[model samples]
Target: MITVTLDALDLSALLCSRVCHDVISPVGAIVNGLEVLEDENDAGMRDFAIDLIRKSARQASARLQFARIAFGAAGSVGATIDLADAEGVARGLFGDEKTKLTWSAPRALFPKNKVKLLLNLVIIAVTAIPRGGVIDVAVTGEAEAPVFVLTCKGSHARIPAHVEALMAGTPESGTVDAHGVQPYYAGLVARAAGMQVGFAIDGDTVTIRAEPAAV
Candidate 1:
């Protein structure tokens, strides 16, 4: 296995880049819509531009909210986050995506990091099915020791090799960048929470499972 390491500063920088990348497209769309409003005199075009602005603004907000929880510190150390709130941000993030999220986690509080890991896994699962699909998220066990399972089913669903390597902390190359830091960060979160994350592929389905680390 190839061990890849990054300093805290580097990790933070890469994660910031990832979050910015997620929201930039929608923000750019909003800018384009504003430009249309400013330069165009056609009422029909102005109406379309207004609609585009609204949708893009909402998309940007949703991506920011999701990143705030998934990639931010979220709260003071040792704080707990409500699963319901996690669900809300998750649904928001998936709103404009081709994929759909079906969350079945309990409406209880879990450690903030654990919830962050769950959300990060949601992102990984989405990538597995780029052509769009259903991500069924389920949590088992108690709040203090929950197990997160995400089943992603879609046509041509497959986990990228680099993603698998990053999540396993054994990247093929010893370099981590914005494009691959999220899964690396997810691995860090799991380690911090004393959990183990695993991924399995079976035909067109990808399963991501996280549970307590083995003794």
Candidate 2:
């Protein structure tokens, strides 16, 4: 097993890199749209720029919302966040991409650490479906001790190897950059919460489960 030690600064840098990567496209689009609106004299072209600006702004907002909860202290401030809110954030995170979601969580709230883990797993599912697919996220057991199960299956589904290495804490590279940050953080959160996280990948499917701490 490979041990990786990451200080607070290292984690912050990698996480910021991840967020910046996700945010760049939409923000760039917004900038381009503004430039087009300023330079284009045609009314139709200006209207097109306006539409692009709106769409990109919304996407940026969604990504920020998703990241704030998934990778930041957004949930920590409140101790727990509502399931419905999490679902909404999940929906926004995927946008109208080829990936779809079927949420089966109970209509209850989730603790901050668990919520963060759940969102990280959701990101894992989203990345698996490069060619598009469905991610079914379900939670069982009581709110006081919830178990989360997420299955993501589709054509060409794959969980990035760096993420797998981080989960196992056996990175051959001896270092984790942006690719492994999410999973590493998720694992830390799970362990800190006295939870166990497991994953099984078979063919074009990946199943991720998180069980509550033993009594």
- The local distance difference test score of each candidate is 0.91, 0.85
lDDT (tens digit, per residue) of candidate 1 on 103-175: 9988899999899999999999999998999999999898778899999999999976688789777887788
Candidate maximizing TM-score: 1
* Model 1: lDDT of residue 166: 92
**Judged by lDDT against the true structure, how good is candidate 2?**
0.85
| The candidate that achieves the highest lDDT relative to the unseen native structure | 1
Model 1 scores a TM of 0.97
Show where candidate 2 strays beyond 4 Å: 75-78, 213-215
How high is the lDDT of residue 8 in model 1?
A: 86
lDDT of 2 by residue, 32-114 (tens): 99999889999999999999999999999999999988888874364987888888899997777888899988778778777
**TM-score, each model?**
0.97, 0.92
RMSD (CA, Å), candidate 1 to true, equals 1.0
